[model samples]
Target: MSPFDQHQPAAKPLTVLIVAYLFPPLAGGGIPRVQKLVKYLNRMGVHTIVLTVEPPPGMVEDPTLLNDIPAHTPISRVPLPRWMNAFLGLWRRRSESESGKQDGTHSVDAKLHETAQEHGQARSLNMKQGQTDQRNTVFRKGPQKLKQSVQKIVGHALNWLRARIFVPDDEVVWVRGAVRAGMRVIERYPVDLIFSSSGPLSNHLVARSLKRKTHLPWVADFRDPWTENMHRTSIRWRLALEKRMEKSVFEEADAITTVTESFAQDFKRLYPARDVHVIYNGFDPEDFMELEGSPPNAPLTFAYTGILYGKRHPRYFFQALKRLIDDGMIRPDDVRLEVAGVLDYPGRSENRDALIALGLETVVRDHGFLPHREALALLKTSHVLVVFGDQEATAGRYIPGKLFEYMAIGRPILGLLKPGEASRIIEQFALGVHADPSDVDEIEEALRHIVTLYRSGALLKDIAHCSSKDRLSANERLCANERLSADERFTSEACLALEDRLRRFRRDVQAEAFYALFQSVVGAKQR
Candidate 1:
């Protein structure tokens, strides 16, 4: 028997069709979770056929993610209709044109300022810099205001149209084509199951249609909730339509799985008869195997990766950092905040501008959008990994995939989070400290505590000690450490328990969980 055969339901391994709109080569948006599932599931003898859209031009691509998938796995990348592609290209050009005009004004003003400063004729620039300043004001004040007004009007119209037309999501445009392609794949393969994941909940819509036609045992996975999503449209009509679509998927799919217990509980509460499972997004251990150990005694560094848009900005962290600098508790040079991934929400306030406004421009290093491996490697150098999420009402139901990635990197996480799964996990595992994302004072205290631990050498000592022994056994010694208080000893035991829990969250283990779910679903259908 094949080594992987034990994982199969029978002598024949199961075949599953994975419908994911965002898959490998797409940088973010819960793509890694779907990619990792395919990678490990294939290893355990499940055959996966992926149906994904061909990435549009200018979409951030991480080719490195594709390396994880087995070569034999069949993948179909359906291209968008030519007209939609043309429309996107036109939209991209207009956005670039507007950005270019703004950047040009800034560029000219910067060059003029540099010349005046180098000449050291500032007060005299009452005559020299005075003229420069007047010209700069005209450049910004007259044309910039006109442009902003025009853009705002255009943005409002576009949002209005989008709210009304894109019933569930913008990806609704791709559904008919995706379902057509899915039909072809089902016809081609001996597909026993249909699995769909969503964020652009369009994928589930496609799966629901497929399930209707094929009557296959289908599992609809929710990396995020649909209508309850913080980013969901607030328009009541749109929301009503989305809830209807969400209800259809919940009622139809044979099994439901989500990334967090909170999300699962919410789904179960709503649909009491549904099979809701919490199959968390996880990290592949092999990704970190080649990473170098963190440098000892290096200037304390905190790093964050992944997109920050909507209410997911680092405002609280910045407020705390500003206090640390002003109080002379930390020098800008001695500590660094490294940020990766998209910092803008496209038509919203830019995160980089916020940094400059707070005079953190020099202290914060912005590495915009690195490939997944490079991002991970960048994180490996940090003393603490940073995780940020919205503090909105829907926060508890959401968990950032970065939380799992940070855990696997084995760095203490500094989570700027609400009281939710992310915060609970950080405290439970003794993984790191967390402060309410909205509370600047709490964030400052968390920062101070981290700095103190770093300066006292206790932090590095603990990391080194953990590295030298089997983490599973370290809890006993940790409890015995006389340096800790009774509560701290309990925390030490919890720290070790994180490793045991981490095993359950490993991608391989998660794949087994998925496989078991697949067996139960398919077996019931067969009977």
Candidate 2:
């Protein structure tokens, strides 16, 4: 028997420790992927222990989302010091401003003046050299040899204070807390593996620390690239250090998994000797239940969910729709574009003005942010799902988690991205249409094609028959397996049936031919 046949059932479940900074009640793109993974892992006989933060304020709590996890799944919640997080944000902003000024307007003389003022104030206040300067004296000297020397000393001192006050335990603080809590859990229970998911990328730090102490095999899951993530733009000096840190994580990990094949390739390229796995995010089959019975609705509602920030602009889609409206190709009242997600950065104003400028204000409806299930429900109601990708370096390398859920909806997709990984996946699945965002004409053509198909009542049939290759391949495999099984059964049941019949026929034929030849030979001899 084959090994697979002998092992009809799986072995004892794997114990997984998931370290993530963002978990439910945190509303973001990463949450769904993490939640689904844990839920599905449990379903597949994996015991999951989640270590995450208590959901930040202003986020909703949904215990039902945790239902997929086994009843006994361990959950560790670490409290983040809100004040420290806030201070870090403030300090980062100030540092950026200071760095920019140092490169631009601030002269060496002015910088010296600033430093002197700070130093005198520290002395007058009887404060230590590294003590507080109510003036927030981060950038006081320009980039000169002597000035840099003074700055380094003062900066180190300030960093010490900041670390003590803001991040008292450094980057591993959260991990240390989780480990302390997790150690107790481990002592009472068993953990087979440590799985860490990252974006705050800090989770890896925690996992790394835990692995050092526990010596457990660790899997680091990266939802996006670390350090080289397109969204991140650090100062030049910090870039090298950040790259080194990212490399350390990649090296120390026993197994690394990413969401997209392209990213897996990139990860492998960075660490040439490492084995990286590509596990594309998948959707729960239940998300498509609504689509099974529903017919396409009129007016063709289009929906886009998730944050559309940085270079992942929606300008192309808006422009094409605007042109269609302007050219009378599609009536304004005949279509509605619904965007459901947080717009702009947190605590910032909305992008209503930008949308208005693009002439999409009236046609586009902003649903803001909604719960995951609610968003999936909304997806079912739409005729098409819009998948937008940035044109930047990270464009096609990372497939958004939403693509999977969108696929699950089984609705036709409208992909506006550069011709790359995302487009390839969409084509491979026969999911939807793709257009180059750079070409308005192509975008218009694709949009019009959908409109024409809808009008002609051929859209549904076209989607059904568009991809038979995958189905045909599956059928061929099944046929081959059936033939192999039949052959095995025939050999076991009646192995000599054909051979016995053939042997009897041959003997009868040979005897008849020999007798005829003997008579012929005698007749010839007499003649």
Candidate 3:
């Protein structure tokens, strides 16, 4: 019999239980991924049940994303108590330190100032290469080592408290609730598999637990890697714990899926024995079909929509633009940069201050945390989309989800990143230009290129054909989606079968061991 023939006719639609900490209502990169998955799964004849937290006060839910979820789809909201979150954060941070991972570090305020001065000097030297006075003047004194040591100690302690104790393992909380709730649902109604995505690292716990209970297969989707993530530094203890957790999940999971090929390779290195697949994030063409024309704005608008982290700094982009403006490469009226998204904690305030200090307060606007759709609308009207690559990691390991969307917009991409995966992708599509994030001159050069093209009105003519070709083909999207879908299907089936056998085997082995111990105890008592 054929493989299809061996399977019984489809009963009810396949049920996908998505366990995510940051879902529709909670704004972040993870939200968009989950929202898209939930939306598309419904179209693919899969019924999705989302298990997520209620948005905390000061956190706004995007109604547009929520509307995309099929009406028939069930959503289970578990309101996380504020106090519990606080404790969890503390515990998680402490756990991170205890595991030997770097939980936090002190803010390098002085170093930033020193770097700024050095950068300024470097710029002067570049402008007059033969001028010894300018070159020597730029190499100023570095930051004090004592202050640096103190900051490192303090930062780590603070990070420990924040990541461990205060932030309850969001994944753990969600997964525990999801497993219990899922079991209740499954007991009443049959379901096939549990699907989850993560950056929080807590979701894996939930998926692992649920798999232990129901014998159902699980698919663990990673939007980013757990240990190899550049934003985080791993302590040996924490690394070991994370490795153990990831290995367990990867081993138990019917399939493991990630967003980028680079991340997939990283996962494979960690879990060499397991199967890992890559699924590049794609756009729904329908959403962009009714494109609203760009609203008239004074300066040539450049927009970046996504979380700004350590490796992906707005300072580089701002400084480069500032240099260009000061040097008259681009006039003030000709350029403006808008950053829209949450600036993650600890560094947000400092970053804001740094921008203001650089005299970019007016030129750079922060529209904090707009809805994804609104951000896309803003993207449509902008002259360029800014794509940042993480400086610490190899450039394609984690391609920002926004890049694909930017390509779909057909706008010129100004990539502020190192030579990596993202740069290669842009080059492959002939979508945009890239520059080293650390080099102000390179950034200025890229900007000058864009400005020249724009001023001459040749940018559109040059990129029009390439931009049209950049559009995601139906087959390409299908192939990308299939990676995750196939992995999910295989993992779900395998996990279910494994759970049944493992649970029984474990019970039998325990029973035999208990009986042997009991007999030995009785013999001793009789003696």
Best by TM-score: 1
Which runs in model 1 stand beyond 4 Å of their true positions?
A: 1-7, 89-149, 293-298, 345-350, 465-498
Candidate 2 lDDT, 115-231, residue by residue in tens: 112122222124222233332222122245665455445544544454333211123445667777666666666776677776656678788877888877777888777655655
Q: Give me the candidate number with maximum lDDT.
A: 1
Q: In angstroms, give how far residue 101 of model 1 lies from its true place.
A: 26
Pick by TM-score: 1 or 3, better one: 1
What's the lDDT for residue 498 in model 3?
30
Alpha-carbon runs more than 4 Å astray in model 3? 1-11, 86-158, 163-170, 295-298, 343-350, 462-527
Compute the lDDT for candidate 3.
0.57
Estimate every model's Cα lDDT from 0 to 1. Answer: 0.69, 0.56, 0.57
For candidate 2, the lDDT comes to 0.56
Sorted by lDDT (best first), the order is 1, 3, 2
In model 2, which range of ten residues has the least summed lDDT? 105-114
Preferred candidate (lDDT higher): 1 or 2: 1
Any idea how many clashes model 2 has?
0
lDDT of 3 by residue, 276-303 (tens): 7665565555556555655233467788
After the best TM-score superposition of candidate 3, give how far the Cα of residue 414 lies from its true spot, in angstroms: 0.8
